[model samples]
Target: MKKFNWLLMVCLSVGFALKAQDNSMKKLREETAGKIKNAEKDTTGRLWKRGGNFGLMFNQGSLTNWAAGGDKLSLSLLATFNGFANYKKGRHNWDNNVDLAYGYVNTTSLGTRKSDDRIDMTSKYGYEIGKNWYLSGLFNLRTQFSEGYLYPSDTTREFVSKFFAPAYIILSPGIDFKPNDEFSLFMSPFTGRWVVVMDDTLSAKGSYGVDTGKHVKSEFGAYISATWNKEIMKNVTYKTKLELFSNYKHNPGNIDIFWTNIVAMKVNKWLSANVSLDMIYDDDVRVFENKETGVMGPRLQIKEVIGIGLTAKF
Candidate 1:
């Protein structure tokens, strides 16, 4: 009888120990699940708190021989504003940007004195189709006011002309491919332009010239750009951009020009600089000649400019 009692006690002890272990495991699982749920809620709260961003930039630069007359002191100031908005749970993302740039130049010691002012504005809307592809369209308007002289006959004649002699409106539809987070390629294979208006005075002056009554009806072109960005240090990023702009025209003799290279750098998040160089190779029929010489030849010119600027981000 004692042996049987001892066996029963041993069985009872084993059962109790197993039951205690099972309860402890269940309690642990419940605590772990609670922690996970709390963490998920915290993450969602943080995401909801995220908001839009605002940025501004100011830039200034000087130019020499701005009008091919001689060395001149040129001053330019620009202001830019940009913003980004986020959607809660949508396939499409939206951003808004505005750029207001005004520039003025004063020429000194050149027989032909001149001053110029210009303004540019642009707007864009974009749709995110997938991870690395985007479709976007943009509209741009630019205007310029200038009072200068073209010393063609060794005489400085007062001349006042609007830089955008014929105001232009451009419609651009393009696609962007981002192979990775830090690089992108954009090709605007299709683009169109409309000359909405022209300065009456400039048009009248041109009417007496070789292009008499000829107005730019439409402009078709393609633009391609490649961008690269890298974080060289903790808060510093290095960036480079290359762009090409060309116009394919129905009238070959129209303004045939090409603008080729642009290089820029960003130091930390608030300071940046850029250099732009453009080349123009035109056909004989498109060339402007001096009345003295009837000879025609390709003209080669180089323009180099540098800029220093301040940037802010929010």
Candidate 2:
């Protein structure tokens, strides 16, 4: 009887221990599964990828009783934002980008002046046709958000441009070559481009290649664009883009050119230095010289910007 009682006690202990271990494992599995489900929900089923950054730069100077000459008092501020949304699945891809920049300066002598201004947006969608090649459609818009003036002298300010007074819109169906994530080339044998001048004064002047007294100008053309982006070294990056357009209806032999380059040096997580260069050549756009003489012609337009600023990425 004693032997049988001891054997029964040992069997009961073992059974209880095994039951406790099984319950612990079941609880662990439930917690793990719950965490995974929450993560999936946070990402919204991994449908889209998004990222962007914002930058602000400031410069100021004040000259008091100092003998050294200066602009008396001056202040400048520049703000920039860039963002992108990209979608990729089995055989379809869509990419979208937005870039905005505006800058201004105020001086006791020069008054308030716009130093830089731009609003650019692009969208492209593609379906894979072969290795590293896709059939794609692209749309882009370029404009500004404020009025611009030409200051011939300290007291002379002439209205040169305004929001949508000279806007460019382009649409193309093309073939895109993307051999890697850092480089892309796009070519479209046929494209449509529109130049818009919304202001009555500007439209009446036939600004931005528009017809005389017309608000809009349309052109059919062949377009090509190439882009390159890469990290040159630790905390340093470079990017460049070039685009060409030839109007088949008007001047098929003359091609328009647009090129831009940028270099960035990251000082820390929140500080950076950047430089940018942009150049544009358009046959239809004319630069007026000696308006007193009524002389106008086309010329290359170039701009450059360099600054150190606070930057935030997300």
The whole-model lDDT of each prediction reads: 0.52, 0.88
lDDT of 1: 0.52
Off by over 4 Å in 1: 1-90, 93-108, 111-120, 145-160, 179-184, 205-216, 220-302, 307-314
Model 1: worst 10 consecutive residues (lDDT sum): 49-58
Best by TM-score: 2
TM-score of each prediction: 0.50, 0.85
Q: Please give the range of 10 consecutive residues that has the lowest summed lDDT in model 2.
A: 285-294
For candidate 1, write residues 236-279 as lDDT tens digits: 44544444445676543444343434344556567766444545
Instruction: Tell me the lDDT of candidate 2.
Output: 0.88
For candidate 2, what is the TM-score? 0.85
Q: What digit string (tens of lDDT, one per residue) describes model 2 on residues 57-135?
A: 8888899887878888999999989898988776788889898899998999888899889998889998999988989
